[model samples]
Target: MDNQKKQPKPWYKVWWFWILVIIIVLVLGGMMNDSSSSSSSSDRKPKAHKVSPFKRTYKVGQVVNYKGYKFKVNRVKYFSGNSMDTPKSGNQYVICNVTIKNDSHEKQDYNEMDFQLSANGNTTDFGEILTSGNYENNTLDSGSLDKGATVSGNLIGQAKKDAKLKLEYQPSFLDDKTINVNLN
Candidate 1:
């Protein structure tokens, strides 16, 4: 037998395996990014984002179809804010915070939300869409968002006598359509 105790298989011996792993990792990473990028998104404002899914609330199986986006209504809260019908443009939005969580597995790069109100079978009042304008921690992930994590912003228009309402959502994934929800 050779004087040299047969050295255990060295790392270099598995060089091919490492290369294969690296290739697989790269391919997987690329695939994930491509898939996410291809997803349809809204035209809302955008900001720097980090990959972290938060949980909120939504109605079960309640899917709202907007321009083309299918948003699931997680939670609904009513607030009396500035009416979008007002003559003024700025400061008209009293900032009615609507807590929403995305149920679609697809990412929603939400920027602003539009709330519309109509009463007694009147015209649909799609409220003026408002953006949070704050991204320190306003990111809704795909699927159910964890409790406590929320994306809050101002919603134009006030509710008068429990009028019919529709909420619009803009995702932060891709540019495509808005997610509209009918809140009656």
Candidate 2:
């Protein structure tokens, strides 16, 4: 036999083996982290934000300001088949004359759905009734208000007879402060 002894392979010669080992370790570590985070997240509670603007209630025929926009509910009238676009039998239509002014410098988009009519603790949405020659002027249909501009229209909703009604006006769905107009 020769005097020379056979030496083991160098670390660089097995570089592919070491690379596979490192990849496996990293994959296992990522999987473990994902599972731990998911489990802990289920045990945590969501944080609540403080409401800042829900401190006051407004009345009808008064200018209510919210987030720099001004709103006013002038008058509320009930019509029972009196007009050509009145509600169906056993139902009545409410016409709320309203005016909205954009006092801020920026243009704000207004949605008619934001105005809800609450009667006897139940809320009803504004409805578009068939009126003579488009008698119902819906200002919110224009979409946006310019700076220092005013718009006036009638908000129509269906309700029952002699129901205690109130108009809820909020600048946006995300806003907490709502102006309630007693229309009874």
Candidate 3:
């Protein structure tokens, strides 16, 4: 044996081996992080969004086919201030009854945001009327419709007493064929 102890293996001599080990460790670490990240997402509640699968090309009385659902504006009614438990001065309520029938194979969800109201060509959202206590209980409920099921509800909004009003029905945000129902 040499008087000097055998020199330790040079790092470069095992460079390829170390590189392979490092690559494996990094790959496994990334995989572990991926699983942890996905789990974290599930720990929080996801935000909700509305989606429409088609355009609005149907008239008020015509059956509007959208994303495997059929919608028809049955009728529109106007209510004066004194007619409700709460009265509003110089303003009236325009309520449109829409009949929605899901024609798809699965259930479909709907909410007040799906319907928009226009007064004298000015657009209004469901939240605007909802904030007012006058039309609180009369508004439609957001719910899911089973396949071939039908649900009818009122979409209520406030408008000027003499305003020319219309209800715009959008089945999804991506749709362009928004059906306009004249409430004049």
Among these predictions, the greatest TM-score belongs to: 2
Candidate 1 on 38-72: residue-level lDDT in tens? 66343244556642222222232464433233335
Give the backbone clash total of model 3. Answer: 4
Q: Write the per-residue lDDT of candidate 3 for residues 1-184, one digit (tens) a residue.
A: 6698878888767778889989999999999999999888877857575443243344457677766877788777776645333325677777777888999999999887988888888988745344444456566778999998988877877888888787787766885667676667
Please report how far candidate 1 places residue 100 from its true position, in Å.
Answer: 7.4
**Backbone clash count, each prediction separately:** 18, 0, 4
Off by over 4 Å in 1: 1-61, 64-70, 79-108, 113-157, 169-179
Kindly state the number of residue pairs that clash in model 1. Answer: 18
Q: What is the lDDT of residue 68 in candidate 2?
A: 73
* Best-performing candidate as measured by lDDT: 2
lDDT of 2 at 32: 100
Q: Write the per-residue lDDT of candidate 2 for residues 55-102, one digit (tens) a residue.
A: 555567878777778888888877776556757667787878788889
Candidate order by TM-score, highest to lowest? 2, 3, 1
Q: What order do you get sorting by lDDT, best first? A: 2, 3, 1
